[model samples]
Target: MDVLNPEQFRALGYRAIDMIAQQLADLADGPTRRPVPLDVRHSLEDQPIPETGADPFDLLDRVQNEVLAYPMGNPSPRFFAWVNSTPTPIGILGDLFAAAMSPSAAGGDQAATYVERAALTWVKDMLGFPQEAQGLFVSGGSKANLTCLAVMRHVMSEGKVRADGMASIDAPMIVYTSAHGHSCIEKAISALGIGSKNLRIIPVDSQHRMDVEKLREAIAADRAAGLHPVCVAASAGTTNTGAIDQLDVIADLCEAENMWFHIDGAYGGFGILAEQTEGMYKGMNRADSIAVDPHKWLYIPVECGCAIVRHAEAMRATFSLVPAYLQEDRAEPWFSEYGLQQTRGFRALKVWLSIQHYGLDGYRKMITQDINTAYELRRKLFARSDYEVVTAGPLSVTCFRYVPAGVPEEQLDDLQRQIVAWTNASARAFITTTMIDGKTVVRACHVNFRTTSADLDVLLDTLTEAGQLVLQGAQQA
Candidate 1:
């Protein structure tokens, strides 16, 4: 049966739009509200599934009150918990239009396919990748990394992996990444049939950049032991500390060793647009494949990531599966031939519309502002005697610890974690913690486009208040 008549559908749609607009307008004060109570959440969870459809307007009311009342806090300007960003308004609209169109983006010469190609071309242009390179839009960093590494496995196998699998390779296929690299690399390796034991964890330097000397030594040792070095997955920006590995140096080593060079630039690749990171991402364009997430820094909505590869045919060799019913005589290649997905969503429209709304220069200015904000955060922490800037690098993340003068070193880790809890509970600011160099530290990632220096001030003031309260309890204990 039909869900609703045209008039009723329009009414419901308008109401939903109005609700979303109101929420967007109120996001500036989102962090002030405490999270939804557990009882409220459990009540929603305990509801039985309805066999019959309910009234659409009633459901909309429940959604507006129950769901929209509680947000994940990322859209709030005071949120510095992780790499999540506030989506652009234009991008949100694009998502709505895309959903309305509802085109299957897997294959064929459809309008959705062309739009994806155009968006991918813009992504390549932004990253300085060659126009001739092949790319695709994936879910996010994890899938982007997996798609690229799957191609790496195929190419490194010399056309044997697709037919015979990992068993065709004689020597163990080894991959290398820094200790500070994203954990997705190891998971990708394991999922690709390369054992985790074959993944070498190279050491990092004082700045948390990958140690080139240690990497070279590891490669040499692997060669000496008759193992094949397939690829080196370098981090453009690590998660915990935002440290950028030496891309140019690692590129040179990969060239000398004839290994596939993959870059997990999902978190901070867009940092290349900022002048502060001018020389950091020098050789990124030279990578065999690179994974980047527009959702993180480009301010696009969630589930928009790009996988770029210099060798298009290698990717086709890895995942091109065509059935007789889906075959068509078209000049353009289908997106399904490039990666693991067969029923891909139209994720490219949001990226395209967002980038169009904010041109490259506009993006550059925003990213530079974010970096400057991060610097201001460090400057404030540096000026204070109670907090120590622990391991923030040259990006938009700052890892710091609350260390009162007389507090014991053993108690500092727990104290920092407690401060995070207290600050979050205060409903004034939201921050997170991470382990850096075996010490617990508060991690603040500035990917929110709405955040400003004033927000940083609020964050510090709330953190200071939280630290005092937590410190009093620790002292008494």
Candidate 2:
């Protein structure tokens, strides 16, 4: 017998829908638990680790009361700690439908074909890539980058790669990335059996963007030693600073060096949807491959990412392994031939539904609002003498540090740590600490669609208050 009867399933669905709707509609008043409550979190492990099944009603109730009530934090209006991990109505419903439908998208002619094709085309075009671009739905940015780079390795070796292994290549092929680039590049290189030594970490300019000259020089030196610079990764937006690398400059360099250019636009690719910053991603069309997170920017739930290739042939060359069962007679083979997925989810459904429900105009307005709020925070941050902004932000992410006059830049860590700790403990807002230029600094990324000026104000106010308390305690001691 089914553990969840028809009636029980209906009730469970309604209950979950209501809980999510209420959370979104009343997000302004929602208490984002910044510092996770250790005591009330006892029920988190109340369930049996490997229970075969459970009563649907009881499970739903427990989830509503225990899990939802005390989540560490969700990206909503009150959340500004990390980049937007917000949820959209259409996307949530689309995820539900996807689970219910269970359409396997691994080039199956019967399941998830049209929607996946549309989603792939949309992403390809949206990033100035060609409509013929092919890719696969992956876990997220890191996985997406790994998959693309793996293909880069395979292609650079000219399809003799997996057959002959890394030793097949004559010279030591190096993959170069900027110091400010996403850490995923390094991880990808390591995962692909390309030693970390092959993954060169190039330096960045003052703005944290990758230095083109350094890249050229590095490639030249590698060439002098007969080292093949097979691939170069450019960042659309870095995770720590949200700074976009100069794609145009890097693209030119890659062309001159005859290297495969991959752009990691997991965070900043969505900016292409916004009108004002649309041109910033101009040179992405020339890239051999690009990775972007539909989950992060499209406001879908987690674990949806794509890696699009400029030429569908390149993708096929990278990953087409004809399985006896999946083999179909075709000149080019199926979409499954590209990248590292055999049976993929209907991940495209959530993103496609969200985009259709809210047109480009709606997304543009939302992005504009987010950008405006960031600038507002910048103004407020600079108003006080104790605070200083590290740089003018190009996107919603603002990197600033709590700096007190006459204090050594090195000691700012102690004070910044206290401020972040207090703000998180207060349950008003949350942020993360990062070391910028060898000095500890605070990072506030504004990506939530529901966030407003008032929430950001609470974060700033709480920061100053925390600083004051720390200073007072220091005086007393």
Candidate 3:
């Protein structure tokens, strides 16, 4: 087999970089979301497995033209349907370098392992975690939540879980979370053999924060029924309306009840970097563990999520099973002992590089800008009689619906759904819709730093036009 020479490699790499740079530079000219051409998929599927190696430059060109051209549109500034961030240029470069190095960050006294530790430590400091707190990066928020819940199960079970499975427990271990909490918590519980039935979905207050009184009542009722209340999972920023559960009150309740406290801060955890939103995250440091995603708010490349635990030893105790062949006499910590994966990639490089390039102060500015923009959008929407502000503030998320005066309550839900479908299909801008307090509403999350006040204005204008068209069609019919 023949490999590309150094000159050929450099030439191909330069072309790839140029293509990416051009794409980023002209982002506004492209549609926020577009369907991939059917021929593109057919071209790949219709081809047989190559018996001989193809020209490296030709393969690279195909990837640049076919694969990189069409994406889910998270990189576009106008893409606001989900909690997605536009990747920073420095972060992209870091990812490229990491891919070239191809280092397995699992363990064993290597630079990649050390880099991961340092990046996690930086994250802890950024989130105001205790000095002794330990963390590891995982695939994303789902796996991060799973990792923390696994540790919580071990610690709450008093280490018996490691020796014996869930059957060893006397009472049924139950976990509690608000209705606004991410579905990952329930998934993690079910995957751990805790059963979804053991998970309690507490109610939320008018502001969408977890109802402290209801939570207290539920815990008491559970204990009275002879059930074991093990953990309380709180949300720093819910995906639906960006409501933050009363963290301080939840922490107090957990302290009194001796239940493990975990915060799923996947989408909005990095909001703590902004000064305006810092107070909202009070008592978050009191959490026993936190799951946060750098890909959402930190503007890093995808597939970077972090799990931090107050008790590092507990995490190791929960996941440290090494065969004799993989044993080593190293004094440094082995990352594989802290999480589920035995083989890991260089996930730290992009995170560390992004942080270094854009310092904490820089990130704070971007986060504050996004938060301010969301609030401004809310204020503007509230001024309109047709728009009802369902939830706003506390974070960079706003949920509202366009309600014209004479529209019947029964027809409002369908009208809102039609508006969303029209706006998405038009592709001027993309915003998602969700149910809030039994009413359908449009939801916008300002996670991308590139999104500006002007963009928000354009979004509102486009939405208004779409809403009018839907209403007019409904009236005509």
On lDDT, the leading prediction is 1
lDDT of 1 by residue, 64-93 (tens): 877877777777888888788888989999
State the C-alpha lDDT per candidate.
0.89, 0.79, 0.87
Model 3 agreement with the true structure over 1-477: per-residue lDDT tens digits? 477788988998898898899889877767777667789878757888899888877887788777777777888778888788889889899889889998778888888887887888889888888968889999899999999999999998899878899889989999999988899999999999999999999999988888989999999999999999999999989988888888888999999999999999998788889878888899999999999999888888998899998999999999988898887845766888999998888989999999988888989998988898788888889778898888885788888888888988998888778887777777667888888888888888888888776777777888888889887887798
Ordered from best to worst lDDT, the candidate numbers read 1, 3, 2
**Which pairs clash in the backbone of model 2?**
77-450, 77-451
All candidates: CA RMSD in angstroms?
A: 1.3, 2.1, 1.6
- Candidate 2 residue 82 Cα shift, in angstroms, is 3.3
lDDT of 2 at 256: 85
Q: Rank candidates by TM-score, best first.
A: 1, 3, 2
Which 10 consecutive positions of candidate 1 have the poorest summed lDDT?
26-35
RMSD value for candidate 2: 2.1
Model 1 Cα shift for residue 443 (angstroms): 0.7
Pairs with steric clashes in candidate 1: none
lDDT of 1: 0.89
| Candidate 3 global TM-score | 0.96
Query: Who is ahead in TM-score, 2 or 3?
Result: 3
